[model samples]
Target: MPSPAPSSPLLTAFHDSYHELVRFVARRTGPQSARDLVHDAWIRLAERQRSEGRRPEAPSDERSTPSPQNIAPRAYLYTVADHIAIDHLRRGQRTAQRFDSSGKEDGPAFAASPDVADTHTYRQALAEVENALQQLPARCRDIFLADRIDGASHAELALRHGVSVKTVEREVMRAMDGVEAALHRWRGETAAPRTGRRRALSSLLGLAGLGVSSSALWLGWRQWVPQYQLQLATAKRRLLRQPLPDGSTLTLDADSRAELRYYAARRQVQLLAGSAFFAVARDTERPFTVEASDVQVTVLGTRFEVALEGDAVLVAVDTGRVRVRDGSGGVQTLLAGQMLRLPAGQSAQPQAITAVAPWRDGWLDFQNTPLAEVVERLARYSPHPLRVEADAATLPVLGRVHTTAVSGWLQLLARTLPVSVQPEEAEGGISTLVIRRRS
Candidate 1:
């Protein structure tokens, strides 16, 4: 270098607390890579500031150099270092998993002799993805990678970054959108091939005019297209367990129906009718969403249930955080042991809950649930239709109803509530339980 750059106030503070920062990182990642993690953290901090169009101001004299506290918050530095350590450890684990006893690389790698044009395009796409990730805000990038690559939970990320779980979810979504946009740009550029000799020449030249083969274009498109599409439904009184392409599991309640569309960028389920519980696979790059009428529930990875009850949509989280947005653009976040109800023409309000989708465990738990709604749910398990009169439809019912014993539960319901059950035989000899207010 012509001359070493003068130390800025921030750099000076970093130097002053270098040992402490390394010690902090060591506790999380062990002493092996602690110093390197701290160094990387400083580089990340400096790069972030540069990207924001701010250069650190250097003190004129040694005496004027501000104290470490005045220059930069030590806590921020520690946070950056902690994130770096997490990434480093995660990468190390992956590396270990990739190599065999003979040290032969077993992870994904380029073919020993791949097609030149296709390889070039692939490398370009990879570079674009990396560039897009780098352009993201430091916190956003770290949070996304930690959740996706390191498998860190949103709550853990929030605690580490000193932010709410909602903030963490937003940052992850932002990062994913950024990376997806970059991939789309790369695909758009490479998907179209030039004509005839020009295309061949461009491939040979390996210049800015590079052209990919039609086969390569098809392969690229395949990566972006839907990987799996399925329509799942349960017969009356039957429960269905389905495994998704991405390793998630779906349990459909009796008479439930759902459509699953899995793409490279997203895993979506349209809850067309009844209720379904999703044990989502974690892929922060591809968020999982459940669309239920006017309400949409989104999560990076979690176990939750979505149900369509008449004009109302119900969402409950058994684990992880879930974000629910209504047709009116109102958003509510539900944590573990929390539930939300969105009625037609009304806003969603999240409430604390003791159980999430108790129906999954062979019982339907109702807390002051309407009689009509309860009857409709029970009808799914009953061989005969269950109906309630208008006067008793709005009556509030409480307690658990075992799915296997709907008849017994109905008997108890008729006993407790001011309602009588009348068994009506239809023209086809099909019996129906008709409940009416007691005379």
Candidate 2:
């Protein structure tokens, strides 16, 4: 080893270290990039070795400063290789940027050497396995790709998708289990005697009918009953024309809403929120009723409006007789052209009125009803609030106020009333209908 030059210890150490570094880089970057990264480091090392006025081979004592104590050849080569690999990545990145901007690549920047190409073939093999995984069930395919391709842990993936970590683990295991089971079955079929194998194949062919029958049954079941079911229900103000499954008609007024539910035991619909008009379909077995707050407006067969205004629940029957009942079993019957107002709270006494139902012909009919009360009803469907002074509140109105058209009502109110009904402007999107006496 005297004056070590050709086939020297330091030269062998450097070459071996470079090869190891290439293998490490190959795991992350493709093998072509790995060789480029490793070769660049070696090129720098060779240039340095050649510069030091040394022979055509490695120098014996002419080594770079050792990285650690006792300064070994392996440690020095590893240090040099790491720095050169990083620099090669930076330079390659700049070359890629320049090529992208200019739309030209003069030569291959990361071409694989023969040995590096062999390592890169592993990548192609993994890619083929990836394509095979796509044929698996959706959940199984997702778990396999996340674990193998993206290298995500089961726990990490489970938390990301709001599933249990055990679910993720089980999915991956299931895919591997499938492969093992398939391989075992294939081997069993192959090693069997010809007669036995033929019999097994015939048995499998016969079972194909069962698979077809099961598929047909599955289609039939989907047509009949579903395994998973979901439905959304909410109560909000709606039009009166919505037909009930019980063959009843609903004539709900504006700002009046009801939830219509047809359950198995009984057709139970709780007007859980707003008010509504009901035209009950006669079911002597299951009498239709409108329950609001505490009072239930029971009817034999009728067209009626069940209005909720502050503490008073007003029931105006337009057709058949309605039996107004308190939740405590007290009932009062009111006939058509008759309105009943029941006070909310504990006292369930009902007041029967001779007034007509306002919305019978899409007009607001008032038999000496307060002017302010009529104005209040007008404000509900309007895109504005109606406001009147206290002095104008007690003025009695006997005419019918048609509310079907917004413009028609506006014009009618302006012409008939002593109070001038002029529209007013309000802040943001709010509008106000000003009802003041004419000057």
Candidate 3:
């Protein structure tokens, strides 16, 4: 065989991390097929990179590149490998079904029995479900399959489809309703008007009577049903603290929003915007995870703060420990008093923090942070809209600004930096603060 060409930066990284990538896929698809899936993933990535190179550049083209600064090669490779593994498993399932239908000798045989009619009815129900799925919109049907067949998480589906987790949940529910209605018709059961939310419960009970395994039923419920869900938000200049169902406490900063989802197997909070402080209760069985921007912070029991600051996701650990992973697959472990900042399309590095979420105490701390980002955080608590000019926005700032005394800080800011702070009254009697270069 001819020798392979020298590897590019991405290919080199893949070669170096081949074993680790195999192990990642193995945990999902088993060790036997992990190597093949990882290799296939690399091939797909290489092809994608080539295709991207040939395409015209556009403002919205955020494709992955080999540069370490653009993305974490290992993380991107893992994501590709994980998707390939799912497809591999799905193909295997389809192939097995085909073999069984062909009456292969090695396939399991059904002996003649009095329960044959039940078997026929069960097969018919499955056909009805398939037919119902085909009638759904393409995206809705795919979301349903990804949830039920591939076991993708709601967060994962949301990310993949560029939608919110709530949207994913709605699509899955729509799919289930269609399938259940089809099954009802197949079973000759009269459809009564449902007055309440017992439809899922009734559907599960009906499937149980059709001889679905207890384990399957339990898994289905866990995948599609939520024990409880809560939406938390804070208005401008206001802070709120609320207790979670798991006995943990969540403190939301001004202009922040989060969605709390408690499942039988996990506890998740999607930080939709702004920042939050979590004082978690110890529960080893169900780990707690907070998703912000493209980053995830996971802990068993910890006091931590996650903030979506500008284009970065900031995770600060006040106590205990946290595992933070970004979209590109970069993972960092932070201990008490440590913090990690994941900037968009950049590598993350852990640093020490003197305080976590000082904004909770009415203080905004900046350490060589961009002026624009500082203004953004301040704007959340400001009654008036705040805007920073392009020339002044990039200036580095290092100081603490009291949240309640922002006007005073603005006076000092004008004196310290070559910038002008101007407040203008707009229509609707609202004042807007604009920061511009002094020149």
TM-score of each: 0.52, 0.40, 0.57
Candidate 2, 40: how far from true, in Å? 76
Model 1 bad stretches (over 4 Å): 1-224
By TM-score, the best candidate is 3
Model 2 is weakest, by summed lDDT over 10 consecutive residues, at 194-203
> For candidate 2, lDDT tens digit of each residue in 70-151?
4566665666555544544555455454444344565444322224543343233333333444457877766754553344
lDDT of each: 0.70, 0.53, 0.72
Ranking by lDDT: 3, 1, 2
Which tens-of-lDDT digit does each residue in 32-70 have in candidate 1?
A: 455545644554444444544454322222223333345
Worst-scoring 10-residue span by lDDT in model 3? 54-63
Give model 1's TM-score versus the native structure: 0.52
- Runs of candidate 3 exceeding 4 Å displacement: 1-215
- Model 2 lDDT vs. the true structure? 0.53
